[model samples]
Target: MNRIPLRAQALGARLAYALPRPLRRAIAGRPIRIDGQELALDAQLLITLQRLSGAGMVNETPEASRRKLEASERLVSGPPIEPVTVRGLVLGGVPARLYEPAGVGDDAPLLVFYHGGGWVVGSLDSHDNPCRFIAVNAHVKVLSVDYRLAPEHPFPAAVDDAVSAFRHAVAQAADLGVNPDLIAVGGDSAGGNLAAVVSHQQVLAGGPVPAFQLLFYPGTDGTTRRRSRDLFADGFFLTSDQMDWFMDHYMPEQDRRSDPRFSVLLAEDLSGMPPAYVATAGFDPLRDEGEAFADRLAASGVPVVKSRQADLIHGYINFLGVGTRFREALSEATGALRTGLALSGRKGADLNT
Candidate 1:
């Protein structure tokens, strides 16, 4: 809503990215090393810019946070990619967007994607760029769900919408030009949490399970505080204060933190869930929990790949529009999704287990 401030921030980002690494590092201040990992120069520079511009996720009200996220999206999201056509649609009465990359045939794999904002700030516009990137790069169709946010639709509202949208995608896959058997569920941060929960619920329901999962720095467990939560609690873009703010709005009742829908990591069984590629950012507070979830998936005989972008910070997926590292990291993710879906297709509907 406030273009002037966001314009200044975008200019700052462009200048920072243009500078040589040495100069960028100089401006970003001394190397920040914590938890045995050195901060990537790109991440450090963005953090510095954020601090200087006073732009962050935390705000006095959820409405303000939502507006800020929309504006800030332009600052970090790179120029839009072409050849990906997006169409508005409704899934099980929930608003959604379908991204179809050029050249992908009917029966292409589809990914049900949820946007991150700790379940409070992100929206269809805020995450449109990344969804396009994934569709174009992975050669897969993407259904980006605009799930209801919290403090307005708290607790299980988002969880319920996510499951419903995913089910609708499966039921209408043929009409939507996708292969139902090759569908995957994915998202970043809170969206990732929903994707993980969807996989669990589908499996437990005993049919029409997602064939794969692409989780990017997902918050898997809200019930336990891990070391990373304290270590990178500040200065890493996604601050501890912001996390608390999100949890307060989304799952206000502290007693419900252990619900499997909120904290999939605490679920009784990880068995029979879809194969997955779990990505974690080194400096993220949710790092440990995400990796722990991946470990459990592996232990339960689910095929899983845990990737730690050792120098990046949280929310890198949205940064793909600005920096090289962000694009590279996300490219790796899309490539994995491409490969995973291709493999899942080969295995046929048996993957629906």
Candidate 2:
């Protein structure tokens, strides 16, 4: 994996994020071609599909899904900067990985991330590159949590672990080398959902809430049949059947879906939550729910920035850290995190996704 070239990519990322939504949609709607692939398929997503095809799933067991996601993340990640300062430790009883860029200060802001995979598959390794990229580009510390998977530890188990991890990080701010005031909580897909739940729980408990929320295509209202769910249910990487499988294994009981912690969109009294930055893919089945959550947050008086990466599909952030257009999207996302958390530094590293 080659590190993304900084000079041109840094400028391109800025312009790509600055382009208006309609213009982005116009450019994305223009179909392009990848060698040995079908039309209209994003090149990065094609790479991901090729990698996933090699890790065939025998069953939906946690072990099988973890193997599958690890392949996808590994194949998608580009070469990172040499000798990155990555370390590992157990937060309380749950394991975690910390990605710190060289020369980070003790006052650097921190991002506590939960990996995606519907809360049943992803591990710290599955999201290692993204965390590294964010830490380097945004000049912040990124702590990726490895919470217990479902079916074995269902419902509130992941939630409990996430909340515990954040509290522990806060309590050990000096030892962890981060600014407690600038700490943020974020995740993608199921991980995003968990982060939102933690933010809400922290607010209600009258404890220190996260400074910001970074949600990527979060599964907010699982019970609602949003239009994107039906439109992109069949293709664009995540299918409705696949979601049903994840939800079934994670929750099983339909009644559990209504719990505010599980379906954050259903939560009452959304006031006093942390400010948020939400990024939703154009073709993801969870697009509507993620957007709805952003709207809900804004309506509740929280500062919010809602961005739609209209050219990409779900999980494009896993791109091998290169100068591909997909990596530019991830760069834009890190920019948002940097601004939201006020991670002060020279911001344009243009690292791989």
**Candidate topping TM-score:** 1
Model 1 ranges off by over 4 Å: 1-5, 349-353
Model 2 scores worst on lDDT over the 10 consecutive residues at 344-353
Model 2 clash pairs are 1-79, 76-320, 77-320, 78-320, 78-321, 321-352
Q: Candidate 2, which segments miss by more than 4 Å at Cα?
A: 1-59, 81-83, 321-323, 343-353
lDDT of 1 by residue, 1-353 (tens): 24456667687689788988889879989999987899888889888877776677867999998887787778888777888988999988999999999999998899999999999999998888999999999999999999999999998999999999999999999889998888999999999999999999988899689989999999999889899999998889998889999999999899989999999999999899999999999999999999999999999999999999999999999987566998999999999999998888877756556
Error of 1 at 107 (Å): 1.1
lDDT of 1 at 3: 46
Local accuracy by lDDT, each model: 0.91, 0.77
Can you write out model 2's per-residue Cα lDDT over 56-97, one digit (the tens) per residue? 221366687777666545544655644458889988888899
- Report the CA-based lDDT of candidate 1 relative to the real structure: 0.91
TM-score of each: 0.97, 0.83
